[model samples]
Target chain A: MHFEYQVDGGNFSNAGVASSQFKKILKQLNVDPGLIKRIVVALYEAEVNIVAHAYRGIIKIDVNIDKVRIALIDEGPGIPDISKAMEAGFSTASPKVREMGFGAGMGLQNIRNNVDQLDIESVVGKGTKVEFEVNLG
Target chain B: MLVSELKEKLNLKVFGGNSGLNREITGGYTSDLLSDVMGFADQGKLWITLQTHRNVMAIASLKDLSAILLVKGQQPDADMLELAEEEGIAVLGSDENSFEVSGKVFNSLMQKS
Candidate 1:
């Protein structure tokens, strides 16, 4: 199954909409509970990253019988240093975002921790593309 | 323990989501960071935090949390309460701080175990 969701940046209230919708599909497909939990964590974190930092984003989820692939591609101020951004407690988010208990710099690291394979690519002035996959097998 | 049981024991105020009052509480996690809770909170846990936004309800619903107890007498935003009701995850409030209420919830869960 293939699903795509659009994310509006700086819209805190709608941050998790994509993840929630995908979760319901996963549940109906009888995806493993543990696997669903990990996907939910990674998806929500990535979803919020776009909402907090991007102009907008497109989330694509492809669930196969053997694996699930997700791609979050966003248009925003891209990361200058992906490695530094992955470090705990390093962030470029505004105080307003911080006040919401987000932008604590744990987003990418948390995403890395939850997915089986992950990739991130960015252009300094353009945006970021985060892709990851989980083996359902 | 059920959410309603904890509410009575701790004398918490129900902001909304009454339908989830009977949800089972397996334990509790206290954190203000959204990602921290998203990464660490287990299913059926009661989240104790001071962050009162609509996303808090999003997390609670996504995490399969039993309830959320707001700290420091904090009231949830209007959207937060509405989402809580829709998600059927009880949103409880407390005048106490996170530390105080976390300890209380800890004891309550421990007693049950």
Candidate 2:
């Protein structure tokens, strides 16, 4: 199965809609509880990243018999250094975003920890694309 | 322990999601950083934080958390309360800080076990 969602940048109010919906789908499909938790965490972090930093984004999910893949593509000021962005405490979020209890720089790291595979591609002044997959088997 | 039990035991104020007060609580996590809780907090945990934004309800619901306990007498944003009601994840309030609230919750849950 495949699903796509549009993420509105700077909209904290609707940040986790995709993750929540995807979680329900996973539950209905009877995915393992542990795997579902990991996928939901990764998806939620990715969703928050777009709302906190990007201008706008798209989230695409592809679920197969053995694995699930998530792609988040955003049009915004891309990361200048992927390595730095992946660090635990590095963030470019504005003070307003931080005041909402996010932008602590743990977003990507959390994605990495929860997903089996992670690929991040970015171009300065353009946009970014993050892809991750978790095995359901 | 159930959320209603915790609220009664800790004397927490219910801010929203009264429908979910019967949800079960397996554990508790206290963190102000949304990502920290999203990354490390487990399912069925009650999140204790000072954040009172709508995103907190999103996180709580997405994480399948038992409830959210706002510390230091913090109150939820109007939108946060609305989302909590919609999502059915209890939003609670307390006059204590994270340290005190977490400690008390831990002790109470431990006693239950």
Candidate 3:
């Protein structure tokens, strides 16, 4: 099964909608509880990244028999240094975003920790694409 | 302990999500960072934080948390109360700081266990 959600940048109010919906779908499909928990964490972090940094973004989720793949593509000021952004304490979020208890620099690390595979591609001044897959087996 | 029991035992004020007062609490986590709680908090735990935004309710619901206890007499945003009511995740409040509230909750849960 496949599903997609649009994320509005700078909108903290709608940040977790995709993750919540995806979690319901996973529950309906009877995915293992442990796997669902990991996927939800990765998905929520990816969703928040777009809300915090991108101009706009799309989250595409594809679920197969053995694994689930999530792709987050955003139009924004792309990460200039992927390596630095992947570091646990690096972030570019504005003070307003930080005030909401977000933008603590743990978003990408959380995604990496929860997913089995992670791939990221970015073009400075244009956009970024992050894809991750979790083994459901 | 059930959420209602904790609220009664701790004298917490109910801000919203009264429907979830009966939800069982398995553990507790205290953090002000949204991503930290999102990454580390487990299901059925009660989250203790000072954050009072609508997104806190989102995280509580997405995490399947039993409840959210606001420390230091913090109150939820208006929209946060609305979402908590809709999602049925209890929004609780206390006059104590996170440290005191967490210690009390820990002791309570330990006693039950």
Candidate 4:
């Protein structure tokens, strides 16, 4: 099964809707419980990143018998330093974003922590695409 | 502590998913940030926080949490309540802040176990 969701930027309240829906799909497919948890966490962290940093984006999920894959593509100024961005305590969120109990710089790290494989591609001024994968077997 | 007893101790108003709640109370973690809560909270503990967003349900679902308490009398939005209902997560509302609620829950859990 495949799913796509448009993530509205800077909207803390509506964030994670995509991940939540994706989780349901995974459960219905009878995916492994541990894999489902990892997929949900990775998807959610990426969704929060799109909401926090990008102007707008799309979160996509592709599921099959063997693995579940997630892609977050955002049309925002790309990450200048992928290393810093992946750091657990590194965050560039504005004060407004922080007030909502997010923007603690854990999004990328959280995604990396939960997923089996993670890949990030970015251009300085063009955009960023984050891909995370979970092996179902 | 039974989920029913924690409800009374914190004077919580069961706002959603009353029937789906687990009777077990393994422990609790209090955090307003959904990210921290998602990373740290165990599968059976009551999650105490003032954050009443859909992501709260998302995290609770991911963690397999027993229930959620919205502290400081904060009420979840209509959409959040509906989502909680669908997800089978008990959403509780309380007049206390996260710290006080955590303290009370910690003491209760210690006493029970």
TM-score against truth, every candidate: 0.99, 0.97, 0.98, 0.87
The C-alpha RMSD in Å for every predicted model, in order, reads: 0.7, 1.0, 0.8, 2.4
In candidate 2, stretches whose alpha carbon ends up further than 4 angstroms from where it belongs are none
- TM-score of only chain B in every candidate structure: 0.98, 0.98, 0.98, 0.91
Residues forming the 10-long window of minimal summed lDDT in candidate 1 chain A: A103-112
lDDT, candidate 4, A1-137, per-residue tens: 78899998878777877877777777788888877777777788888888888889998888877788888999888999999888887888888777777888887877888888999999977789999888888
Once fitted onto the true fold, the runs of candidate 1 whose alpha carbons sit more than 4 angstroms away are none
**Which of 1 and 4 is ahead in TM-score?**
1
Q: For model 3 chain B, give the 10-residue run with minimal summed lDDT.
A: B55-64
lDDT of 1 by residue, A89-120 (tens): 99999999999999888888889999999999
Using TM-score as the measure, what is the rank order of every candidate, best first?
Answer: 1, 3, 2, 4
The DockQ assigned to candidate 1 is: 0.88
Residue B104, model 1: lDDT of 94
**For model 3, which pairs clash?**
none
| lDDT per residue (tens digit) for residues B1-113 in model 4 | 76788888657799988765555778988888778876667788788888777777767876788888888989897877877887787898878778887888899888878
Docking class of 2: high
lDDT of 1 by residue, B26-90 (tens): 99999999999999999999999999999999999899999999999999999999999999999
* i-RMS, each model, one decimal: 0.6, 0.7, 0.6, 1.9
